[model samples]
Target chain A: MITTSALQVRFGDTTALHPLDLDLPGERIYGLLGRNGAGKTTLLSVLAGFRKPSAGAVLFDGAPVFENVRSTSRICLIRDDGMVGDGTDNLRDVLDMAAMLRPAFDSGYAAELLDRFGLTRKQRLGALSRGQRSAFAIVVGLASRAPLTMFDEAHLGMDAANRQLFHDELLRDYLAHPRTFVLSTHLIEEQSPLFEQVLILHEGRLLLQSDLDELRERGVSVTGPAQVVDDFVYGLKVLSERTLGPTKQVTVFGGLDDERRALAGRYALELGPVAVQDLFIHLTGGVP
Target chain B: MRRFPIARFLLSTHLPFLVMVLAGSYLLVAVILGVAVLVSGPASVSAVDVAGQVLHWLAVGYGYGAPALLATVVVHGRTRREFVAQHPVYQLVAAVVLAALITGVYAAEAALYSAAGWTQAMQPDRPFAAGDYPMIFLANVSMLSIALVTGSFAGVAVYRRDGAGALALVPAAGLLVYGGAVHGFFSLPFAQQGLPMAVTLPAVAAGWVLLWACAREVPLGNRVPA
Candidate 1:
């Protein structure tokens, strides 16, 4: 179990992560999505114990994680560029060191992942392709089996097909072993289904961190006569509204109640579910 | 009982030892080969003489590489920055302890050479100046200081989000200045062993080291290299 309480991360004059609290427990996927500079990486760093929060603290199983080897050794963080081992380009040496340092390291799984990705253990990482390097990072994160694992931009340099493969492999591994997995990505549409909870960061602040299913339920477009739709939204929180021909469609925050659904049915108003991307666009106020 | 011993975590960082040992051995081997092939005039040297030269200078150069190698091993890990912040005091102490080991080994050898006439047959007059003998000591201290500075600098720089570039550049930059100054002003004539030079230069190395160390105040995790 892992939790961050009032964690604030600042770099130089820019505050990368605003004060926020979060809980990521065992055996589920948590998806983190944000616009550029939304502090997703900063938040993950705190949780993984690779960074200390300017304020607040991250706890693992009721113990503070910062500078605690027991806590950190149990967490694996896979970054976008695949970390270089103290600036050394010897990929095998890095892997060997990782295998040596990490108690739970699954050498077989790491080797298998490397093989599946068509990467030789002997090839120097500097000479490898970007996708291969990202693949190497993914292999380390997954195979390390650190109780709490996060993949930040793990999909970097991955082709569409390879991305899908990574997703499938990650889910399979998680289901079989059942540990924490936080996936941060810009390709939200492809990965949203894999997350039970979604965190949307906005400008160093958490605009939203809640259930993905609840978020999905919040996105309903009700279409009807302009006057009828307007009347229906009188007491509801509207996210967006548009008109087509003589009809109007309004998106609202709360799901329609039984009474409202009945009214829409009787008045011949159409109500349909909107996908996560559109919901995200509404939540972050960013263009879809 | 505390989960990880300071000694264990301290020792775990020296995995680079294997790599460095191999490098040091290769360098020693090349030196032996070069000396054997080239250190000849009207007559060639004997095996014992060759061994004497190789072991002597190696004992001499051991201090130079020891400190840097120890620091490189001590202040290194999965990431450069993590290596430093994990145990700043512990790492420094370990590097100094390893430096002492290199010197201790050489001191023991120096005593053995003096007690026994083994080296006398090879050369009644050693091939080094009196100043050169002390230079080994200077080399050890400066090398260790230089290593700690450069290693710490690289670690701190990597924390600033330019880890790869900084790691590559830190050693080169530090050595460029240190080596340049040593070559130029190390043993200038007509002075009290350039007392100010020794004091000021090591201080400069320490200053460069502390500057990056101040930068080491950064907080980052594996998820965020920054």
Candidate 2:
């Protein structure tokens, strides 16, 4: 288990991540959704034990993660931004270093991934295309085989086919060796199915945290008479409403039990599933 | 296979340049010994004085070269971060080994210098002995340790704030500060007799402690994912 309590991260005058508590359990892939500066990276860094939290502690297996060699050694964070260095001559050199250093590194898997991506091992990583660099990062990340793995914005540079390949590989690896995988991405709908739980961070605070399926079922859209929709939505969180002609589609992220279903049925109302992405857009005040 | 052999990693980082230190130390001893004999005017500089001068030149090299070398290990960006996470203790071990290698290289030069000719023979009373050789080795090691450790400290400190360009200043700054500080106490006529070890000893001990602290204190921002 990985957990943070009342964690705050600040850089000079800019508040990157405010005091927030989060718990991430094992054996699942988690999707973290956020905007450009929504503190996703800060949260990831603190979890990886690469940065010190200003106020709180991150615990792995009930032990503080910061500088805990055992915990940190089991955590692998592959940053999607410009974290790779430039001066190297070729991929072979970097791979050689990896072979020497990363204890659990899989050379065969690395080579296979390189071949699958059509990357020449002789080519210097610095000279590779942006897509290839992300691929290389993926290879290293997966091969590291740490107990906890986090990939931040790793989808941006990947093309449709490459992203699909990554997801397939990620699932395959996870099933083969069950571990915790947390990924942050802006492209939600395409990747939502992979997530066991979805977390959305807005600005510096966590706006939502729920299982993917639970969040999908959290709200229902009902269409009927305005009075009926209003009556049905009573005591529920009515997220939004729209009326065209005599039909009404009032969406609310509240439960619809047997009584509510009977009421909707009596009013000849139709209930529809709320898409996670659309609901997220509504929650974050993004027009959809 | 070895579970991240930090010693081997350190060797890989510093070994290539250590060859340079060996060659440089030998040539340095020859040049300084010859110059001391020629310039102190045939009248008096002793073998001990020539050895001290040669050791000082080696210290100069450490001050100038060690920072540049250390900067390479001090984490510039992605590659460095990976290097640090994988090879965690390599730089600290490299600093110590580099200091030791430099001292050994200089000590070997002292043997060559003795065979070629002592700048000033110990005369009718004191002759160089097997025990004295170890003292000479210890003194040279202390000097090199002082230079390299101090260089490592300044290198890591300034490198993180900026990049390679910032570290470029460390070599020049370290040499000046250390060079001046070493020659400071010797200016007093009463302490001139006790100056050589006095200058190198505290500086070496202090620099070792400082670099060790630096290895622990080095921080690369927001690297681990939260």
Candidate 3:
């Protein structure tokens, strides 16, 4: 288990992460969703021991993580820049170093992933394209087999096909290995399916943490006549609305109770599920 | 002492590069000295004297390379404590190897000068006699090791404190000044009084201690900008 008590991170005058308390139980995939400058990267850096907290404690399996070799050995965090190797170093050298340092590193698995990603061992890290670099980072993250692995915006430049491959490989590996995986990404809709739980961050504070289905259930899209729709959702939290001729559709933030559902039924209103992406947008502060 | 894997890894990676650079430097010095002999009818200074500059610069380069290696090892799950502990071992071994190679260059130069019937004279301020190979090795080891450690201290200072790190050059210069002064002391008649070791050893020890203090708690930033 990973736990933080009043964990805070500061950069000069800016408080990147406010005092936060969180408990992340092991062996599950967690999707960390946050807007730009929402402190997702800061949180991950602290978790990975890359940055020391300004205040508070971060413990993994009841042990302090910062500068602790035993705890760090079980954790791996891959940032957007693929911090695995220096630019001048060859890809093979990076893998060799990983093999030496990372106890659970699987060289054969790494080699297989390298081939699948169309990356060669002889290529210098600097020479790889942005997309290829992301691919390479994914390869390392997977092959390290760390008990806790986190990737922060690690798939930013990957193409659609490659992203799909990454997702497929991640799911396949998680089933076989069953370790904790925290992925911080902007591709919410495409990646949400892989998340068993979701953590939403807004303005350096955690907005919410819930199961994927439960979070999605909070949003409901109601469609009916324009006058009737407004009357039905008048006192409720309305996320967004769209109109087409005489018909109106409004997305509401809260789940409708049985009483409210009966009322909607009497008014001939049709209620449907809202996409997770739409809920994220509305919950994070509707429209930019 | 327990086996330090990180230190061993550093030595394995860096030593080959040092050897390659040393070979190239020796070849370059040999070519220059051969040309000087052909043109001026046997130069007074030995090839090792001209080639010695490479060891100093290489020591500085070795020290400057610390930040990159620090990043690599830290990201690979090694602690700063592990790195700082093993790093001096790496530096010591490298310095000793380099010093021995340089001493060999002196021996080879002596033989070549004797074979060609050329008198091999050294600079007046040099700590050792022209034919004293052991003192030559000891002096080079001290100078080169100090240079390397100073370079490492400055490198980490800059790494942790970006723009303000430039101020480290002040202390770096101080360390080098002491390193040079100790060599001059070695040439003095009172060298056996242990004064040079007293002054120089503390400065070198202080450099290593300062490097550990600065690096142990430094927050690692992304080496490649996002």
Candidate 4:
């Protein structure tokens, strides 16, 4: 398990991550969802031990992660913007280095991943297209086989087809190996299917964390006559609502009890699940 | 088969450049020696001149290149989010290996010069004599080690600090190297006026300490080099 206590990160006078405690268990895929500047990358960087926290402790399996070689060696943080060094190294060199340093690194697996990604080993990382670089990074991250693997906005320049390819490979490899994976991304709807749990960050603070199944169950939408919907949703947390003449559809932010379902049926109201994306936007006020 | 072998990785990553510098410096010095030998006979190209010139060129090149090499490692390590502090030893190991390789080459060249019956030019204020091969090699190693370590320190200094900060510290570092060189501190094993190992070794240790201190301060974020 990885946990932080009052973990705060500050860059100059600006606090990138406010003090907050967090716990991340093993053998699960965690979707870290946040808008731009919501501190997703900063939080991941701290967890990777890349930067020291300004005010708290980050521990991995009961030991501090910062500067602890044994722990860090077991963790791999892959960022789409860049990885390891200046992107002057050839893909072959990068893989060779990873093969050397990473304990569980599978060279054969890396080779296969490169082929699957349509990336040649001889291509220099600097010369590769943006999408190719992202694929290359994913190849490294997956093949590293580190116990804790985190990818920070790693789909930046990928086309839709490539993005889906990555998601499939990630899930396939993840299920085969069963290691901890944290993916920070803006493509919430596309990636939400793979998440066992979701952590939502808003303005440098953790807004919510819940099981994916549980959170999906929480966002219940009720649609019926405008007067009936208003009466049903009254005194409840209404996340969002849309009105079209006499018809009204309201998305509320909590699960309904059997009694509430009976009441909805009695009023001829329709019930449906609100997509996680809409809930995210409603919670973070991202759309507004 | 070894996991990482960081020191080996450091060495291999840099071997090509080191070899290039060694070959380039050797060719330049060899040409100068060849010209002198052709014009004034082999007797004109003394053992001291050959050894001293080789040391000068090789040391200067390695010294200048050491920081660039270290910056590459340090920055890459940072980007990987690796614990750079624990790995500074890789740079130290690289420096020692570099000193040994260059010194070994210098020794071979000196032996060839000696066999050719070249006169001793007695440059670098250190006069060479029969059976002083060990002392000459030791002196060269010390000089190269000092150069590499100090260069590493300068690199870390520039990496951790901004333009004004790095510039402000350069003069002091320049003075220290100049003062040590002029006073025969660096030519320790061969010169009559040389400082003892007791002092010189500690000086080298101080350089390592400074390098480590500066290395620990290198932020693990992308900072464009100015």
TM-scores for all candidates: the values are 0.66, 0.66, 0.90, 0.77
Q: Candidate 1 residues A1-288, lDDT tens each?
A: 988888888777888887788777778898898888888888887776656688988898888876566677787877776764544446676666566667787888888888887788778866767787788778878888877888889878878877877888898899888898989998888999899998888888888877888888886888899998898778877777889888998887768889988988998989987567767777787564
lDDT value for model 3: 0.84
- What DockQ does model 3 achieve? 0.45
Give the Å error, residue A2, model 3. 0.7
**Candidate 1 local lDDT, B3-87, one digit each (tens):** 3332355456552463366346545744664575466522232232233333322322332232232222221223323444433
What class would a CAPRI assessor give candidate 2's docking? incorrect
Rank the candidate models, highest DockQ first.
Answer: 3, 4, 1, 2
Q: Compared with the true structure, what per-residue lDDT tens digits does model 4 show for residues A1-288?
A: 789999998878899999979999999999999888999988987787767788899999888877666677678888757455346678888887777666688889989989988889888877888788788888888887888989988877888988898899899998899999999988888999999999999889999999998888978989999999999999988888899999999999888999999999999999998778878987898465
Runs of candidate 4 exceeding 4 Å displacement: A220-272, B1-4, B28-97, B100-136, B161-192, B195-200, B223-226
The superposed Cα distance between candidate 2 and the true structure at residue B26, in angstroms, equals 12
How much of the true contact map at the interface does candidate 3 reproduce, as a fraction? 0.52
lDDT of 1 at A136: 77
The backbone clash count of each candidate, in order, is 6, 9, 0, 0
lDDT of 3 by residue, A122-189 (tens): 99998888889899989999999999999999997899999999999999999999999999999998
True contacts kept of each: 0.10, 0.03, 0.52, 0.15
- lDDT, candidate 4, at A186: 85
DockQ of each: 0.14, 0.08, 0.45, 0.19
Model 3: which residue pairs collide?
Answer: none
Once superposed on the true structure, which residue ranges of model 1 sit more than 4 Å away at CA? A84-88, A221-254, A257-272, B1-82, B85-185, B188-216, B221-226
List the candidate 2 regions with Cα displacement exceeding 4 Å. Answer: A82-86, A219-274, B1-5, B13-147, B159-176, B179-201, B208-219, B222-226
